[model samples]
Target: MIYRNKTEAYWEPLLTIARDELGIHSFDPMGKPSADIRMCRVEDIGRALERAYDLGLMVGHTVTRAGCVNGECA
Candidate 1:
């Protein structure tokens, strides 16, 4: 599925949390697993989740916004 927000403003912060906070990096599927795809420990997931919550990205049980910036909410 296509992402609603493809801008760097939307993705950069999320990527920072994923790469800097969590051990898992390199979303590239074709890259080497050893260096590119690091396995995430349980603690890593917890830390990322906490960071996401603090950033107001994920609240309660919802995530997707009500409307899209391009007026293509569906």
Candidate 2:
């Protein structure tokens, strides 16, 4: 149950911790990014960690493409 609001922080860190600490597997892409987090489910911690890490890296790439270099998306 991942409810998102346009007034919060990214959930990637927390979700990653959940996988490592609680062994709860979940990830999804059902939110307005930069203001929302996704959720999904898996059966194992390893899988969850893998998927979440992959997603994190992917998102990083997305940010890099249109990233601000000199205070603008240069």
The prediction achieving the highest TM-score against the true structure is 1
**What lDDT does the true structure give each of the candidates?**
0.63, 0.59
* Per-residue lDDT of candidate 1, residues 1-74 (tens digit): 23455475547666778887785444445545556545678888889878877776454223445345456567
List runs of model 2 lying over 4 Å from the truth. 1-9, 12-43, 68-74
Candidate 2 lDDT over residue span 1-74, tens digit each:
44565244457665667767555455544466743343445555556566668777887887776576545563
Scored by Cα lDDT, where does model 1 land?
A: 0.63
Residue 67 in model 1: lDDT: 42
Residue 10's lDDT in candidate 2? 53
